[model samples]
Target: MFRFDWKMTLFVLLLLPVLIRLGYWQLEREAEKRDLQQLYEERQSSAPLPISGVDWSDKDIGWSRIQAEGYYETEYNFLLDNRIQSGQVGYEVLTPFRTDYGVLLINRGWIAAGPRREILPSIETPEDKAVIEATIYIPDGELMMFGEETLSGEQWPKRIQQVHLARMSEALGEKLIPARLRLSAGSAGELSIDWQTVNMQPEVHRGYAIQWFLMAAALVVLFVFFSFRRKEKPNE
Candidate 1:
């Protein structure tokens, strides 16, 4: 014999789809992460290209390996605040580089914030013409993250939450290449170099999917147990 409860069944019917959908969503993310990592590896193996030669209109300029022969714009510099490395809070050093092709921002890498925020680290920029090899990295929605005052300040090294190409171009009085060149390890003027293609591993996404699915299964089991009932004989 079976017992049917319309209210409980309706509630489950509405919720089951949502839980199952979430599980599938995580699985989709897992697959996408795998694809992105593969692309990164492939790009890394290729030979480096000149920064100015590549077309900037492409959607993914983040992983480009490029060479720029130029001198660091010593006067203007930016320190991206709230960067963390090895459990220590720090800042990312960003210096403007003037190349023959164009002017672009170069991320020298992370540096400790020192004992206090007010005490800025002394960056050693090369006054002479030098060449650097690096990979381009443009964060998503970088424009919205900045404000009108982000590029403003009397200080030589401005502290900012994020880089805005339009604001920076206006401040520096030069149109930049629209991405930050992350200096490669061992490159001239490089500091700590540790960049990851994907923030979360694909396996972690799959594990989350399993947890959501397990909850959905438990819901089904409870609904089934309540639906079944034992038949009793009536006494004479």
Candidate 2:
């Protein structure tokens, strides 16, 4: 006859729920990623929309292709730190563009980092007023700060670790639009624009969910096998 191991049963009961929960969580993440990918594809396929005063209120305007006529404010610029391209350290140059409604931050492009951390790179902004085409990229959520949130400097080209629109607006002494425009190809002052909307694919999340579920199943099988196996006969 087989004997029940209450300790093993309790351990499995405790761990099974956690594993199952993790699997379900991954599945939820997969669904979210799938929806986001679909939305991105749909937006990219549509015609470019003009940036107007009425359209500014739409929160879902991010990632939408837009066109605007503005003059770039070359005096004050921001260098986004820790940006890497082709295995070389660089910074994404963000310049403010004064449009009819308000000033909008435009991510002009990327530039290679200088020899030392203290040395800043030279960024040339387009001089004349021009019509620009770009994709709107609204910064979402708060950044995880390891130390101070703002950069330590009061200079022309400020170096920043993360984008904080409110803080930046205050520093620049002008109210800027809450989003950034990623310069399109052939646009003035454009650089490498390999932007990724979704970091992980839905299939990857589904695979992780399957792994967690398999782990749970394996635990159940081992528990059953160990609990029911016949004990070895003792030598007389």
Each model's lDDT comes to 0.81, 0.84
Off by over 4 Å in 2: 138-143, 232-236
Q: Write the per-residue lDDT of candidate 1 for residues 83-189, one digit (tens) a residue.
A: 88998898888888888888878898998887877888787777888888888774522335433565665677778788767887877878988776788888777
Per-model TM against the reference: 0.87, 0.88
Residue runs of model 1 more than 4 Å from their true location after superposition = 138-149, 229-236
Worst 10 residues of 2 by lDDT: 136-145
Screening candidate 2 with a backbone cut-off below 3 angstroms (N, C-alpha, C), the clashing residue pairs are none
Instruction: Tell me how far the alpha carbon of residue 220 in candidate 1 is from the true structure, in angstroms, after superposition.
Output: 1.4
Q: Write the per-residue lDDT of candidate 2 for residues 119-217, one digit (tens) a residue.
A: 999888888999888888744344587875664467879988888888888878889887777888788778777776666778988999999999999
Model 1 is weakest, by summed lDDT over 10 consecutive residues, at 138-147
